[model samples]
Target chain A: MNESAPNPGDRIPPDELIDALFDGELSPRARREVLGAVRHDARAGADLERTARVLAALRAPPEAPDLTDRILHSADHRRRFVPGRLRRMTKLARAGVVVLALVVMLGVAAGRRAWPEATTLADEQTPLADVNEAFRDDAAAGVGAIRSSVHQVRMSFQAISTADPCVARLEIEAAPPHARMLTAGFVTNPFGIEDERADAPASIRCGAPRIGAGPTIWVGSNPLDPARPAAPDDTP
Target chain B: MLRSEEHKLIREAARGDQEAAASIIRHHQQSLYAYMLRMSGRPDVAEDIVQEAFVRVLTNLDRFDFRYRFSTWLFTIARRLYLNAIAKHRPAYDTDMVGSWKSSAASPEAPVEADEQQEARRDTLQAALLTLPPDQREVVILFHQHDWPIALIARHLDMPEGTVKSHLHRGRKRLRTHIEVAPSSGDALAESLA
Candidate 1:
């Protein structure tokens, strides 16, 4: 076969032909041709032998009983849940996203109600900063005189503009007198200015020299009312 | 080609028959498990991967394309699962095949010294197989161990026939080199090649 090697004319490379021999792709006649050549040629013989031994050495371990059982058990587990559980999980995820979106929307609405945009006080010429200082001074003076009776005061700030140097007013209301050092706190608008109006009841008895210490001071019951009626001598 | 009986079992298993499913698992589990064990070099991981592969195969049985061999499709699914496991960076299953080989050498059942010697030789061959690149290792394994034709391997791996041939040739050459330089009694394995 090697002596009269009919050059099949580049149709089949020797390496490819030999590889096909191992793969059993060649016909019986071709198989005999390659097997005979491999037997006679030293290099070709080594190639076939090496391939065979390496293949032999890679023997797989025998299958165990437990491994088969585990596989069957796992298949059973998937049969129980794969389709149904996937659809259910997808539905739960969509519901969760909708709930999160609604919570965010409600949060924005509640924030707007709690802190409205600023509104101007009667005297627009006084900067809100100066009004804040005056309110602080009044509270400080009243703090000593009313310390025995007044326990806590709620100060609300209303701003007329969102930017700095905007107009605003601080109205102070005191809770019934308590033991601690006034347990002081302040309320500021979203603009960070400490000013706004809130109605105090006459029963609570709020008193400061600048803010009227009378029943008419608490006449208007609506906390949301915009009318901040000034006193007889202090009318703006 | 699956015999008529095996084909019938496959059809029954696909139709939610539990007993047929068990029979199907019994038929294919050995070769599948062995292939995974040799590929990953970890018995524990091989077991896990084989189980997961079967789960996927059974759950999607309706999608099985009948033109191909069942083992080919099964191994293809198993290969993909193995690759995904590697991609996820799951911890390597301990390389305890060698450790077990050591303990098995002293087993009371193997009372003959030749049995111990054969175990040692088998352990060396296994170690060499594990050291080959995974691609080369798998081709050599499917070709040499499973007797899969090169064409079938190309189909299973979704690669060109030329590429599969290249891998097989390079893999055999490398395995020869690996076995030659292996740590234990290299002469014994080298003689096998000769």
Candidate 2:
């Protein structure tokens, strides 16, 4: 490097002076004299030249920020706002959806309340009659309805073991002239002879229970059908 | 003069204005970014470092002393960040890399065009400087770039003036060898030596 250059900031010479030389930091008189020697001195000349070039380049700007582009990409926003009115709109929409859902659920609840008795008629009655009925009674009161006609019908029986096989509570419902009927009685298609002879009662007929302040109406039955069906007696 | 108004904005920001905080970034970003990029030799890394430094400065604006120039303070922050980055990404410099740089690839007399061309010149210099040992490169840059008195360079670097000189002499000598052999770098090197 700069061999024997006053041993660089020492008692031998001021450290600051040598540093000044390296940085071209000297005042005019000193700079001229120091530079003169360096020029004459082959080694010092080359040293100063390279030193100057490096310095000049360093003084130039470093790569200008490509950061703006990258920061925007990373943060996913070119600009940030105050989170103002848009936030209010989002909250309003979410509240509206929740309210709509609640209203629909409430409507369904009201409908179920109005028609309570009709909802569960299927479960209380086990296998109902497979009646071969050719009768239609358009009655004012009904709980639930499933009607099918057969020429000959058979219903396998599971007797209660103690009660009469022919007896069940019968509910006959009609319009204003008659109030609803709630009665317990015996029903017999006796003899187990596999007959469809009694079409007069129009197969196994039923109606709603008695009307009351409480909201409910249903009919109950004990099943009795033979294993098979034979010809109807009313055919003639 | 005020590092382009960031110090003023920082004061306003510290006084509880959120908008002031934004103003500080806008004002100081370009110059600070330029400084960091020159200091750190990687363009991509330099970008990240500058943004982070600005954010940090904004957050800690209250801690700044009133006496010092804001650019000096900002630069000190930039330098510290640059050093930390160098440590984290401490690359093993293969000596072969020093060969390709070969001083000035662009002719000193080449017609200057875009501002980016000037930037490329600095980046090239930064790359070459990184080829030097850290001690020599720092002294060399401080000396030539600032042309500061040795006392200032010494204070700035926190090294003794003697050490600054040693680094200067040795760094300049090493650089001279490359420049003499460098193509198109003729006059700048010649003028410096003269």
Candidate 3:
């Protein structure tokens, strides 16, 4: 047969024909032509023989039973599990949102409850530069006492609610009354004329002393109806 | 009748029918596992893919269309699950099909060896198989290992015959030369995988 002319017995080189053969992708006539070549041509026969050996090695036995079970189980796990998964995901998302909202709410509550702790501009300019430090000291030393010598003695203060000044009249828990020159004032040392006025209770009863010790922390059953009823005063 | 039977069983299983679900499982598991083993070359990984496929099928039986053959639908499900598994754990997969992927991929205990002769042939074939893209690989495994024809592959893949032929052509071309060499020598594997 002529080398260039087509022959029923001549097979195309493998590189040229393998793609068409595997899928029968070639035109029917061309496939017939090529297949004729592959079967009859000695070179093509050699090529196919070599190729079949490779396919043979791939013929490993079926996979293990356990692996087969595992695949089915995995597929089953995916199929059977959806509702529970959706329910779980939804629950987790809701729980997360709830936790986030709760955190925000807690932050707002704390902000409002601790309002008094916010230091005013005047306090910033004054000695109580560290307001939190002062409140902490006050809590530990004693409530409402300005000086308790509880080691590092300190004071704390907030605005006196009313513009008009008021007195603090609580029974002093005197650690030692002998050396106790307890001068209770509003720390208003610049205005010297009313040191004693500042020392007295701004809202005292008619005949109550200027400054004396009594149990300010109300303890008795009728502490309000004191041991003796005092007359009223128009100090307001 | 087969479709209706599978449909009935699937319907029952969706309604929490364990026996029916297991019946579905028992029917398709082996074939699905074998296909995955060839497609992925990791019996253990293929095992996981099969299970995941069935699980998805059962969970979504309500969405299953009865017009198609149940086995066809099952293979589609299996194919999707396998693809998903490939995606989820990407880096470790041997793209070139070297690194003992076929054997190590299974139980991690499948006996492997240094025998250049036996293992070399297997490695050469695997490496060539991996060269084709994933779709081509799917078609090849379904066609050769399972002996499913082009029409069935087309139905399961939802692709046209021409496209399936193209993939198979491309896949076979990629593999044909490598297979021809026999890999009796180590250098052949080195060159093929490389």
The prediction achieving the highest DockQ against the true structure is: 1
> Who wins the lDDT comparison?
1
All candidates in order of TM-score, best leading: 1, 3, 2
Query: Candidates' DockQ values?
Result: 0.27, 0.17, 0.14
Per-residue lDDT tens digits for candidate 1, residues A1-236, read 12222133323337767656666567777776666667766666766666566566665444433555666677777774334456557669999999999999998778777765532235555688889999999999888867544422322222223311111122222333342224322222222322333334321212122234233333222233325444434322
Q: Write the per-residue lDDT of candidate 2 for residues A1-236, one digit (tens) a residue.
A: 22333322222333344446555555666655555555565655555555565666656543253454343233223223224355557669889999999999998788779887754355543333322121223331232221111101111122212322322212111111122111112223322323344442412322111234243222232113323232322111
RMSD of each: 20.4, 20.1, 20.3
- Candidate 1: misplaced stretches above 4 Å? A1-20, A25-50, A59-66, A80-236, B1-3, B90-108, B190-194
User: On residues B23-74, what C-alpha lDDT tens digit does candidate 3 reach at each position?
Assistant: 7887777677777766776656776677667766777778877776677777
Candidate 2 clashing pairs, residues 3+ apart or interchain: A9-A15, A166-A187, A167-A186
The top-ranked prediction according to TM-score is 1
Residue A9 C-alpha lDDT in model 3: 61
Q: Residue A146 deviation, candidate 3, in Å?
A: 81
Per-residue alpha-carbon lDDT of model 1 for B1-194, expressed as tens digits?
25677778777667666677777787888788779877776666677888888888888888887777788888999999889877775455324555553322245676676665565556666777766777877887898788897788888888898888888877766766776566354556545434
The better-scoring model by TM-score among 1 and 3 is 1
Give lDDT tens digits, candidate 2, residues B95-140: 2232332223245676655333543444345555665687787666
